[model samples]
Target: MLSICKIYFMLFLYLSINLFIMALYFILLNMEVFIEYNLLSFNSLSMVMIVFIDWMTLFFMSFVLFIAALVTKYSEDYMGLDKSLNRFILLVVLFVLSMMFLIMSPNLISILLGWDGLGLVSYILVIYYQNIKSYNAGMLTALSNRVGDAALLIAIALMMNFESWNFIFYLDFFKNDDMMKIIMFFVILAAMTKSAQIPFSSWLPAAMAAPTPVSSLVHSSTLVTAGVYLLIRFSSAFSPMFMDFLLFISLFTMFMAGLGANFEFDLKKIIALSTLSQLGLMISILSLGNSDLAFFHLLTHALFKALLFMCAGMIIHSLNNCQDIRFMGGLSLYMPITCTLFNICNLSLCGLPFLSGFYSKDLVVEIMSMGYLNLFVYLIFYLSVGLTVCYSFRVVYYTFTGDSNILVLSTLNENSKIMLSSMIGLVFLVVFMGSILSWVMFPFPYFICLSFVMKMMTCFFILMGIFLGYECAKFSLEYSIKAVLFYNFSMFSASMWNMPFLSTFGVNYYPLFLGKIYMKNFDQGWLEYYGGKNLYNSLKMSSSSFQLFSRNHIKIYLLFIILWLMFMVSFLII
Candidate 1:
């Protein structure tokens, strides 16, 4: 008999297969199906719920479900010993459902519903361990996402001028209008927060406090990609100014995450940073007027990244939840299968030839070379690509090829068949999904012409990155002393340019300090003096005087009369 987790795994897998078939059919026939239900109507305006189904939507949803299915299966063994396994399974299912809603909706109102759902469920999952670190991570994750939620709400209100909430229909029609630009601005803002671009990026790495399975799902296909997907759907509405702005921000983000990953020590956080770098790549390319390329990379990234996280989870699980790469070395010797998959994913992440990531990532770089971008953009883009390989090789060296730092008594092996099977399922996709998706998405090949130097630039940087990564990982007395000499720089880079501090403490400190001052001067001091307390004191004093007057009224009147008689008698005598 199948267990509850297995049941869900099968259910999602079946749905994923069906959705893929439907997506293929839709793509082949060039068809879209819109299902809408009118909820209310007033004065030529209508409120309706819409499900917009196209090849993109169906394909994204299918991939999401497929990843969720494997993740659910993987979680069975990964989280098997936990007491609240059922609750975890339920949360994962809810998260997938919310993602589906997000993918299917063209209306802002319904999108917010899914958006908020992702935020809420993710917060719960982040704090699943019930610790202070998890709590803090959850708070940061939730609040960061709330910014995007508010942006989406503002967008929904702004779209009211069109008298229709279906943004897909109006995106191209209103592309040049100022109001549409404002709406698109808000939409891009929301996407930025969701995808953790630039200033919003700290939350993605902080969210590693969640369980590994949750991390795999949240980082891979569901929460972060929602932003990219939305931007893809609304690609026609982006203005030149907005595109340029997005370009710089995303380019910086890509560079920052890659550089930070090289300095990071935590295994999961490094992977999380890599995810941020890829998201930056997606948004940057999208800003360059290639939403399809961004979407293609998104799909390819989802496959390998999910599998990557699964392999990381297995390693973390076997090591009793120790996620520091410094303590994880010679893993390939013990857990051959897990390390092999991990290295494969890392190589794919580096865009090695014939791998899944190469199909999309290499194409993106080549096409970027053909664009009219400036020298600064080209330099940073290539440098970031190099940084990606540097970190990938760094992680590989630290966790797999270096001397064994783990305890000798620690038994490490790929013993969990359930977990292994789930990862194995994704491994195939990570190897083939890119090529398959590239062919399906692009019926016609992209024309490319580049000089020899320009064409060889990517390979040159990759090779340089490999050499640097090896040198960086090598341990020697001189290197150790040099690392200490550069301690401050290392700290800054490792902390993601102090992004976590900037996002949490740097943002909150001034506001909280101002609130303290306000409480002292206004709420507790001046307001108390001039408003409630003062009023109460004045009322009390008047009440006491009236009581005294009332209590001594007869005596007071007698004294007054006597004084008046005395004055009259004195006047008569005079």
Candidate 2:
């Protein structure tokens, strides 16, 4: 009963957000409703006037209210389904609120608060099922996020040291090249970790342990978009180093995840790699500083990716009774609506002509063609795009088509009406989003739509992947084992981060066992054989004593404690 009531309330909220945003959308998404506001003391202002607002504020506000609705809808169905629904809903709402504040925050301090809030919420959501697997994934997300958060924090401290926390004041803070470089370094680091760029990307796939709705929110729109938003926000401050970072990270991640997705067997894991790869596409586009294209891609990607994810959720939910694609096959006939939605969503995701991704993504491609990237790097990107088609089609194929089309999938379709409705709505977007976007941008007109030679390549790969999946279906067992080895090795290597070192050594020195000297610290390379990790462990175990003694000195400990609090207080105060 409580679940039902929450669903009703959520529906009410969703409707309200739609009504409110729709009223503004005709006036906003079309016109220049993105007002940059100025503020004076609220003391003399009317209650309404005292509340400052802008397009960004509206975006945040609408997003939160809509998410609240989605949560309510999700909650009504998920209640009593997952053991930790209460905490999950709490975190979801809190996470939405956090992103809301982040979108409107004109200063860094408020954004950090939102950033941290999402992190905590994501952590809780990931562990909502509360098993050893979920716990480990949650911990991984927390620790990895800190790498990004720490960078942003260091950058913020440096900025606040010189100038106020106002966006306008950022120029003053970034006047010195060294300080700017430091800030860029930290921001890039944070962005990399947050964005799940390669070497740090393994966590996202692991995060599939999270429930479907949580995955929908995190993977589709809110959490991952933060990194892209950061890059867009700080477009001017980016230096050669920063661009190099973006260029390399974006290219490498796109290629890596593209390759990873081709080989991944876990249903959610494939989508996870796809998410990282597409995000890499966005980053590569953003690196060109073509804001319009990047922003449009952001909007388009938001729709199709969310649609695709929700569809993926539908597949996973219906078939995955705690099992993944490893257990799922031949589900097309039972869940026809879902299968059809998945196909359209993937077409859009692959930038099918006259589809949603075509205009915005192609715009990025067009712009990059005019940029400084070498031909080989561009070739790698184009090939990655081909991989997108391959995996997107593979996901659809494995889930839907089979040598025996009408085969009974052992899973039941238990999707709630609200979940089905959300899925349907996203499908609507998948089919018509290109038309909707055509009005806003020039990618597709009513009579004609955008398609390049790239679409032909995508088509080729997708057709090949479908045939490959079909042929490979016989060798499924062997493929699964090999896939497990490859994916696990990649994941394990990512956890170790020693592969880059080895790659370097392979290039420079012996090609076999070619590990770097520095990476000897990360892997049990020499450590497991010789007691390197154990030796480090012993030092760490006893190092606390050395640290405690230093800390136990009255002046030192007191100063340290005060300084720590001081650091925190200054951030909040800023």
Model 1 Cα lDDT, one tens digit per residue, 1-574: 8887999999999999999999899999999999988889999877777899999999999999999999999999988999999999999999999999999998888999999999999999999999999998999999999999989999899899998788878788888999999999999999999999989998999899999989999888999999999989888989999999999999999999998988888899999999999999999999999999999999999999998899999999888788988888888888999999998998899999999999999999999999998999999999999999998998888888857888878868888999999999999999888889889999899999999999999899999889888777674213655677566676788888998788777997898899999999998998989999999999999999999999999999999999999999999999
Give the lowest summed-lDDT range of ten residues in model 1: 473-482
Candidate 2: stretches off by over 4 Å: 1-68, 78-80, 172-176, 320-322, 403-411, 441-574
- Superposition error at 536 for model 2 (Å): 31
Superposed model 1: Cα runs more than 4 Å off = 39-47, 475-478, 481-485, 517-574
How close to the true structure is residue 280 of candidate 1, measured as C-alpha lDDT? Answer: 93
Candidate 2, residues 423-442, lDDT tens digits: the string is 67556655675556546445
Cα displacement (Å) at residue 208, model 1: 0.1
lDDT of prediction 1: 0.91
Candidate 1 TM-score, C-alpha based: 0.90
TM-score of each: 0.90, 0.74
